[model samples]
Target chain A: MGEDFAFWLAYLTNGKHLAFYASFRFTILAAVFGALLALVFGLLGAMARNSRFAPLRWLGTIYIMMVRGIPDVLFFLFFPLAFEQSVEWALSLSVCSAEARAGSAWPPCPAANLFFSTTEYLILACVSLGIIFGAFTANVIHGAMRAVPRGQLEAGRAYGMSEFQVLTRIHVRQMWIYALPGLSNVWLLLIKATSLLSLLQINDIVWWAGQLGSPNFLPQAGLVHGDWRWAYYTVLFVFYIFVTLGSEQVFRRLTAWARRGMPLEA
Target chain B: MGLLEAIWTDIQLLAFPALFNIYFAASSLPIGFGLAVLLALGKNSRNPVVSRLSSAYIYAFRGSPLFIQFFMFYSIMLALNPIWWRPMGIAWFAMSPLFIGPLALVMNTTAYTAEIFYGALRTVPKGELEAARAFGMSRLQVFRTVTWPNMIRVAWPAYTNEVTFLFHATALVYFTLPVIGNQKDIMNKATELFERDFNVFLHFSVAGLYFLVITMAIFFVFGLVYARMMRHMPKERQPHRPRLRFGPKYIR
Candidate 1:
């Protein structure tokens, strides 16, 4: 039994398994940066939707409706590809001759073609994650903004706070209480979306799991193991469940903190 | 005129692909809905083991991403193929994405839908249940007359959202499952067209348009059902009957 335990330990700590462990960082990084971007985009979107300016409101409305209507996987795949093509299109205009531009192939010329490394792909994934969840966050924040009592804003005005001050201090500050639940929901979604980081060619945990779990056969040593993909994927399935559970606990505390000393009288 | 013609052609090409998506959702939803009702009742069951099992199942599925779920289940089914599926003489059907895709989707939508139904079950108006019991109705009769109606009414709006998201999730099927021959869904076909001409904007926009139009169609049909459900209520108190404007939570 002791020998068996040692063999299992050695097997798990092999180079590939260690790399699988390291690949988790990409998932965490995407979630963190993606969440921050989503918050920024959400605040802007909700504010625009609530804007006094007609065009801005229309822009926000269109943004929310359009993004929310489509499945996230589409945008997740589209944005990076679109961004690359747009850059290439601009590059072709500057570098390629007019005749070259008339060609049917992509990039117009070889010189204008761009390849993204893992870092760029990860960044693109983050941005796409932001755009998708940002719409969700905007909807949540917009509703929460309306849920804020008018009397609170009126009190800020009565106290001589400027319009911006009233918003930043009273309205937006208190909006957290209502928005926390929805934002947490978005966070759950955003983290789950981090699984798609591999689709952009970022070597994330999901990619590693698929690679490591496939059956291995060595020419010299013979069969290593049959397919263990189910085991690896089960680990991932549980990993996400834990992430969700952890986020819920943290959001619970955040909601409590947001509501602290605010008084039920409001 | 050129751009319009290209778009019209692309739309025509995508229409066939779009049916694959519609088939995935249409095939899975009825089974998902039925199982969801049972799972919801299981969660709400008086038996502790049943309740715990149902809760754990819901929590696990709900907490995880559907993308991973698809990959996980597909791989597991593959791993089981040699031992379990192939020997059973049904691997041809069991191993196909047509079978596995909706199977995974059923597992997923069941969780989300059951959660909604469970919430509705909880909010089924205790007074009404008691009133029904006091009238000497049996449990099954109480369920049919009082509990079931209240549950459907309370759950319908959320269920509509679940259905839309389920439809949206059909996009993920081809991503994880192996495509047979030319059978492709919206995203797959769009990617293929993009690879051909490199017109990322045109193809993707048309694809996105398909999803958006189908989502609205789902809402329109569900809203009609919702309106019918709430017909007994006073006109003004009917919550405006699911107006087409983006109220909230279109695609969860």
Candidate 2:
């Protein structure tokens, strides 16, 4: 027990491992934010796809159709960079205006100092995740919206409800029951994908795990432990399994509650 | 014209690696599919041993993430034969981006495809198996003629989607391997282009477009194959057939 405590202390206090532990926050943050953003984007996309307007429907359909076809990794790299550059450009524009007006080397005032720092960079990363997963969420939500029977909407209309009322009261409420299962799948996938945020230098768990496992610092003098990334990764695997199981249980319970009166399969 | 030539050369250079990746993915499908189908069969098997082993394989593969599996394989190889690199002139299969890419994908894809095949196999009507047995058909013959063909017919659509997903997932290869000098993949090249040229927007977009084009091509070809297969099917078992809608319909 003492040996185990020492081993864990040595493991946790390592600076790189500390970064890795911190990275879990990013992972959890990204997962929650991405799910929420994707939910919003997905809802809007689904609404647009099912809209009366032709172009909006086409736009929504195309987004759903195209994104699933393209790889998530591609979007991971592309969207983040695109968002970063856009933010930088906006900053550059502000800076240039300040320099021109004040005749100083320093840039002028902006919305917040945070935007100039890593805070905005991380925000951009979050936005990228949202964009990447939004298409998946849209697919889930669109299917869910469709699952809300057309007759339900007509029934609402028969009760003298407006289109907006029918959508808000009947369609939206019922869509959750159908969407929950797929949305849960999307959430699970998003969690796995949070690991990829390390590639963007967000210092996520995978990155830190690699850092702590490197033999560069530790000289415990046993087997040298050169490339034991596997062990750390194994821990991550177990972590993910636990997370997925917990979330799945929660989602399953939610689904059961949502389907109180419906058929078992439904 | 020079720019056009460079682009052409780039495409030409990418052709072999792309083919290699595609070959690796395509070949693994059969092996993985075979393993998965066997497991699926085992899952439904009357024998306890077969059932238990397959159920275990399915759970282990499905429950874990793929990236960790790749790393685990690499570590295990190195630990087993540290000097294997000296003789073979290859350090580790995991470090070899080529091997890691395919290994991870095959393992992951196999797990997925197995479930798909298993589902389809289970849905095969019991009456058909009974009829085959009644006709003095051996177990192998029953499987070959009655079960296998119907499984393929039922599982083809889901199988097509899996193939597309596998092709897309191949991008993960870039992160796993030690990409030597210029032998990088489209994703690798895109990453390098971003760092070197700072043309993140242009380069990534180019890579994304490349992936989009390849995915479309695969989809079209598969569509053709699907159409051909459908044409060969009995008229009654065409797209409008109710059995075409196999698996859960949670997603409308």
Candidate 3:
């Protein structure tokens, strides 16, 4: 047992483990940024769906409806490559045109030469997470907004508050209370979805686990590891279970906190 | 002419896989629903062991993400018998991708839908059950007449959503499963487009459109169900009560 402990401890301090820990940071950054982006998108979507303008409402409704139709994995795979190429293309045209005219720099600016580096790839991955999660969050928030009573808004208007004021004060604040459960589930799903980042070659923990456990690691060959990628994945499973379980407890507490002092209303 | 030929080929490629997907979604739904109901009944049974086992099954499946679940089953099945499936006691026909892929999908759906049914069963009206008992119906008869109808009606909307959700979620199988039906599955073909033409926008946009159409069809069917259910329901019971706050007490 002690030897096993020593083995793991030694492994934990290496560059792979550093990358693994960094993956958690990336996951956190993705989650926080994704949540913020989703919230913005959700708000815009919900408001537009509720709006009087036909085209705006249609656009928002279509976005949410279409997003709900497709599996999230496609979005994850599609967005990064597409976005990268689009960005690169735009940059190439602008940059190459300027550089071509100026005749400057060692590497001639060309369309084929333009490519997103690793950091840009990571950023694109997060943006993909944000886009996919934003659509889900939109559906959740849209439902929560609908869940809020029309009477609340009418009462606000009865008190001479404008539509904007009613929305800001009554709707936005109360939507959180109603939306918390669904949003929490979405957030948990987002956490699980982050594991798919390894497929993007983003140097996530799962990627490292795949690397460290593969038989190709000749240096670490004499260790007790075999085709234990599954074991490493099992560790991820446990980590996710813990993350979700812990977050659920927090969500329940938050719900209680949010519901306090409400007039015994449903 | 070239563009027309390409479009025709794309449609031909998509035709079989799309049909297979439709069949997959339709079949798994009933299987999942039946499994869920049985599990729910088990959970509600007087026997503690039965209840506990059902609880464990639900928790284990629900506790983990579906991707991992799919991978584990796919790998383990491949590992255990490279040539034969022990369960069927027959040669697995290792080359045939159809068997395990759909099986994995159905198993995952069953695990999820079972939970949903269990939840709906818990919310079955107590007063109606008591009323049915007053009518002197036997257990099985009461279940047939009173319980099942009401339960189905009450659970229809949710069950419909689950069907749609599972259909949407089937897109995940592409990473592991080989496409059947001339590689017709829309996402699989769309993915091929990504690799072949590298036209990310065009392929995904088409895939997105296919998904939209399928989702609409699902919604339309469910909407009809909703309408029919509403028509049969008592006029006074049409309005839905606001969902109760169950977090604080029940969560722990």
Candidate 4:
């Protein structure tokens, strides 16, 4: 029995399975970067919604509404193409020689034509995910900010703190307690959203799993496995469950810590 | 073709796929809702084994990507040969993506909607159930008359969102599964046009607009239902409670 286990382990850890590592690495990197970008977008969105100016508030509202109303997968497909083309178009005007630009109907210049490498696609995936999820985080943070007691802000003001001081000190600190649950939820979504990276043709884990599990009829590929996609997908299934459940536990602990010494008002 | 004519041709090509998208969503929601009620009941059962099993089922489905789930379901179904099994020796399992696509969507939606139902069940007022029992209602009667209606009422708002999200999810089917005999969803058709014409922005934009319009229609219909169903509640109670924010929880 132990020998059988060893054989399978050795097989999976071999050179052919090296692509799995790439998928795993990119998935984690995308999630981390996406989360950080989402934080920035969410903070800005919330502030804009709360702004005194009508146009700024309107911009934030429209951004959130459009994102929330649209299906995320559409954005997943649309953003990269739009972004890539826009970049290429800008480069065509500025970077391409006039001779190179003369023939093509669209851009008319090979110099302006940008073929996105896998790494660039991965970056775009992260940015797309960040932008899509940012709307959701903005909604959560806005609610959390509202949930912070008005009395607490007034108390800060009574203590002779300026508006900025009160916001930086009390509002931001207390908002975490309210926001942790929602933020954690977003984190899980962001992680799952990383799965869509494969759809962008980034060769992420899902793509690798599909390719590696496909039936290898050609004997020269060195592996003679039949279609084992189910097995590969099962591995991904368990990996995701473990990651999400682990995040859930961590968030629970964080929430508990945040709520410590506070009045139980929920 | 001129730009207007080209766009018109793309739209004509996408019409059938758009119909399939509606068919996929419409078929899954009710079936998933029924399965979800049973799963929710199982999760809320007194037996630890049943409850734990249901919880594990929910966790497994909710934790993984729906895209992966669709692929996994297709692979597993394709791998299984029902003809090899005796007694019920039918080849129904080996059917085309048309059949399997909805199966995947149903299973995934059931897991998500079950959690939503289970969460609502948790909040069913104990006093009402007690009152039903005190009035000589049987266990089934109490559940049917008091618990079920109240659970549905509480879950309606979230369920509306779930239905909309499930509609959005129909787009992923063709990406994961092989669309047999030109059977494709709107997204698939849009992708085909984009590849054929290299008009990335126009074709995809039209597809996106279709989805946005469908989602708005869903919201509008559900809003009417919400108004009628929730009319008896107090003004404060009628306001939709914000469930868990974003992510899997949003659908749940």
- DockQ values per model: 0.67, 0.36, 0.25, 0.54
The full ranking of all candidates by lDDT, starting with the best, is: 1, 4, 2, 3
Superposed by TM-score, candidate 1 places the C-alpha of residue A78 at a distance from the truth, in angstroms, of 0.8
Off by over 4 Å in 1: A264-266, B243-252
Against the true structure, candidate 4 reaches a TM-score of 0.92
* Candidate 1 local lDDT, residue B250: 23
Estimate, for each residue in A140-234, the C-alpha lDDT of model 4 and write its tens digit.
89889999999999999999999999999999888989988889988998888888888887888898888888886665766667788889988
Once model 4 is optimally superposed onto the true structure by TM-score, how far is the C-alpha of residue B248 displaced, in angstroms? 6.4
Writing each residue's lDDT as its tens digit, candidate 2 over B1-252 gives 365674565565455556655765676677777777777788889899988887766655666656556656655565545656647766644356666566666677777887788889988999999999999999999999899988987887787777777777677766765677766667777676566645565566556666677767776777777777678768776674221111221110
Off by over 4 Å in 4: A1-6, A95-104, A217-223, A264-266, B1-10, B82-93, B233-248
Runs of candidate 3 with Cα error greater than 4 angstroms are: A1-18, A95-114, A143-166, A216-224, B1-8, B23-27, B46-49, B82-97, B131-138, B177-184, B222-252
| Highest DockQ scorer | 1
What would the DockQ be for model 2?
Answer: 0.36
Q: What share of the true interface contacts does each candidate keep?
A: 0.71, 0.45, 0.29, 0.61
lDDT of 4 by residue, B1-252 (tens): 588887787778788889999998888888998999999999999999999999999888888888888878877875674334233555554446767778988899999999999999999999999899999999999989999999998898888778878898888888988877778899988888777655678898788778877887888888888788888888886776432224337541
Q: For every candidate structure, what is the RMSD over all alpha carbons to the true structure, in angstroms?
A: 1.7, 4.9, 5.7, 3.0
TM-score of 1: 0.97
Candidate 1 overall Cα lDDT vs. reference? 0.90
Residues A129-185 of candidate 2: C-alpha lDDT, one tens digit per residue: 687677777777878888888888999999999988998999999889988988887
Candidate 3 lDDT score relative to the true structure? 0.69
lDDT of 3 by residue, B1-252 (tens): 375676666666666667766766776677777788888778777899999998777766666666665555555555455345655565445434566656766676666666766777777889989888999989998888877777777666666666666776667666655555564466777877677756677677767766767877877777676767677668787744212111111110
